[model samples]
Target: MDIDLTRTDIIKIVQYAVGGRVSLIGVNLSGLDLSKLKLSSVDFSFACLKNVIFSRANLCHSKFQEVDAENTIFHDATVSE
Candidate 1:
C-alpha cells in the first residue's frame, strides 16, 4: 500500500506519529520540515527525502537507501551502527 503526500501534510502526519511507530515507505516528502520528530524502526528506503529537514530527528533503525538526500538536513540524526 502506497499514498501520495505533500510536504506540509507529510510533516503534520509525521509529527503526529512522533514517539511512536509509523511506516512512511514510498511517500514523497521532499523538502519537508521533519525536524523535532522522533521516529523508530521506520522504513524510508525508497522515499524521496531530498532537501528534507531531519535535524535532530531520532532515526534509530530507519533505512535510507536509494533515497535522494541531496541537500537534505540531518545535523543530529541517529542511524543504525
Candidate 2:
C-alpha cells in the first residue's frame, strides 16, 4: 500500500524512529522530494521510490533491497554501505 505523506509527516516518522533506523518496507515514496533531510540508516527494502528526490540527504547505511527506485535522484546525497 502506498502511503500519502507530506514532508511534515515524513519528519515525524524520522523523529520517532528508533536509533535513526527507519523501516520503509513496501512503502511507496514516489514523487516525494526528501531533499536536504537527515534520513540515514533507513531500510528501503521493497519500497517504491519512483521519481523521489533525495538530493543532499544523508542516506548512509540505508538498505534498498528489492526497492523500485526508478528515476530517483540522489544528487549530492551522502550514501554508503
Candidate 3:
C-alpha cells in the first residue's frame, strides 16, 4: 500500500515512535521535510525517501536498506554502524 502521508501525519508517527508506541516501516515518505526530527530506530527499508530532508535528525540505528534515497539530504543526521 503506497500511502501518501502528510506532514502532520509524519509528526504524529514520529511522536508515537518516540514513545515506543509505533514503528514506521516501509512507509513511503518521498519529498518530505523531516529535518530536526528524532527518528531513532525507525525502519525505512524499501521506502521512498527521495528528496527528503533529514538534517540533524536523530536517526541512530535506523534502517535504510534498499530505500530510494535519491537526492535525500541527511546532513548531520546520526547513524550507527
Q: List the residue pairs that clash in candidate 3.
A: none
Per-residue lDDT of 1-81 in model 2, one digit per residue for the tens?
Answer: 465676787889999987778887888888899999899888889988999999999999899999999999999999998
Residue runs of model 2 more than 4 Å from their true location after superposition = 1-3
- Candidate 1 per-residue lDDT, tens place, 1-81, comes to 233665566556656786655677777777677786666577787787777888888889887768878799989887664
Candidate with maximal lDDT: 2
Better of 2 and 3 by lDDT: 2
Greater-lDDT candidate between 1 and 3: 3
Clashes of each: 0, 0, 0
- RMSD list, candidates in order: 4.1, 1.6, 2.5
Candidate 3 Cα lDDT to native = 0.80
**1 or 2: which has the higher TM-score?**
2
Over 30-62, each residue of candidate 3 has an lDDT whose tens digit, in order, gives 889989987787788888898899999888878
TM-score for each candidate, following the candidate numbering: 0.72, 0.90, 0.83
Residue 58, candidate 3: how far off, in angstroms?
A: 0.5
> Candidate 1: where is the Cα deviation over 4 Å?
1-3, 6-20
Q: Which consecutive 10 residues in model 1 have the weakest lDDT in total?
A: 1-10
Which of candidates 2 and 3 reaches a greater TM-score? 2
